[model samples]
Target: MRLNAENIKGMLLRYIVAIVILAALFTLPFWGGRYIVMLVMLMGMYITLGHMWNLLAGYSGLTSLGQQMYIGVGGYTLAVASTNLGLPLVVGLIMGGIVSVIIAVGLSYLLLRMKGMYFAIATWMFAEAMLLIVATVSFLGKGQGLFITEARKLVTAQIYYFSIVLVVITTIVIVVLLRSKLGLGLFAIRDNDSASATSGVPQFKSKLYCMIISSFITGVCGGVFYMSQVWVQPYASFSISWTVAAVFIVVIGGIGTIAGPIVGGIIYVFLSQYLSTLSQIGSLNMVILGVIAVAVILVAPKGIVGTVQEKFGFEILSARRWLGKSLAKVPVAPAPASEAERES
Candidate 1:
């Protein structure tokens, strides 16, 4: 609860490292090739999506397979808002997240009732249903989808910078949340909801809060992605592949840790990109990726970051409890007893 000297040092170190990395990434467009910038932008999008999904599934224990629902909702909302309202792309991006928040609020009641495999199935069903619904709506382009004519005119540099800004915003929000009391409650619930409830954690409220935040961020990512693509189709936007990618990256990187998703995203993107170049494998790249994921799970169930931290005692983004335990381990002299007790 209190920011001790060690905590302050850790905070400063974390911020310094983040600032340095951001400074380097921010200058990529100036000297880096255009293709490299685009590739980085794509990585940023996946990182944001991975972070959002990890917050809910990894930290909150709410494994949703329908995150694409929000992604689709966000993408469609951006397309509509920009086309119909004549809003700026920035405004549409904000609107996309807001619309996702609204949808999450309405969907939480029913979805939250289920648990385990049942919950997963319900989410997938919901996403499919939404895809069908969106496909039938003329305003949403009736499956043909909608394109943001205005966004199409924007250059890749502008889109790449915007993507970076969104990723940074999402990372900051997640880091802040994970350091708060609510974040502790989230981790507690993830470990054991019944125990957490007995210990005064509000299970439903914490889960819902995580869901809303995750959905909003995911929605924004979707909007940015489609804005850059210049088009959105129900089949592609709402494809379950988005969720699969999130789960794969999070699982491979280390679930429930802030650094995990980013590591996972980078690894997944690079591996996928490299595999795609192999002419022999071609369409079988995903199969190879799946094999690797399985191998990682079998060898290191905690994922890359988690395994490294466990083995090396590293704490780049350790939880508060982790820091507390480390601090507790340090030897300290016992305080003198009360004067009356000493006299006695």
Candidate 2:
């Protein structure tokens, strides 16, 4: 049997399963309350953002602290478009995404020059610069910031439904990316950047592509989040903690695999909420997170998914022999009486 056929079959099977899961989630907003909706939306953002960050730091080996740069840009862009331009909120949301894309392309040119901790530091500084710029810009209302022109009712049900749809789309994109040929280059880069380059993989192009895609998704999420808040301020809009949340989400869930964020974000979200009630400081949550991260790093360096793979001997990494196993268990056809007759 050809490898292509087997690969196609696997891809098809995954998509079919994904569609069903998404459909089930689409109904959640109708049944759940405002808080539930908020948590789901946040989980989606954290998971998506974590995956995006993972693509850079975990896969492409480009750690960045400035991801919120694009997130903030998206929020501000959405605000401007929805209000002054008289665009629909959705259109404004998309425009925010476009802005983030533009920023990714422009920044990659300069930022890509650095790598390792240097890259991370550059990104952190870039985020700070964004905060400073937003503070001084009068048209954008300077540091004081801008809010949506209108204050509206909760409409939690509607927002909840919207969050469900967005999460579905985001999840689909992530699963597809992980299963595709992109994973080959991504894993290689993660393992050894120099080797991946020498192996004919366009290192810069792959990294840049990841950045653009990651930033675009994060930007869109930021847009939605801005709308959810019904306000946009530079500090909150471009937050370092947003980046930190994403990092922790990926770390706790599993860094390289797509499933990690889903698992990790869900767990972390609940932990934060539960712990927040215990103390005004939420110090318990932080301490627990810190301890878990340290343990996970030591015990499951590959992350939650990695640990699972280890325990179950499931090979998600393509390099592993079993990853190439037949998704469809080919059955041996028994020779029928007619076949025996024909052979005779």
Please give the range of 10 consecutive residues that has the lowest summed lDDT in model 1: 323-332
Off by over 4 Å in 2: 1-20, 150-154, 282-288, 315-344
RMSD of each: 4.0, 6.8
User: Candidate 2 — worst ten consecutive residues by lDDT sum?
Assistant: 317-326
TM-score of each: 0.90, 0.84
Residue-by-residue lDDT tens digits, candidate 2, 1-344: 34577678998887788778677567667676668867887776666677778778878898989888877887888778877787777787788888898888898998888999999999999889889999899999898788765324436556555556666677667667665667678788889888988998888888888888888888887877777787889988787877877888888888877677788878778877887888787556677778878898898887888789779976443333233253334434554678669899
TM-score for model 1?
0.90
What is the C-alpha local distance difference test score of each model? Answer: 0.89, 0.77
Candidate 1, RMSD to the unseen true structure: 4.0
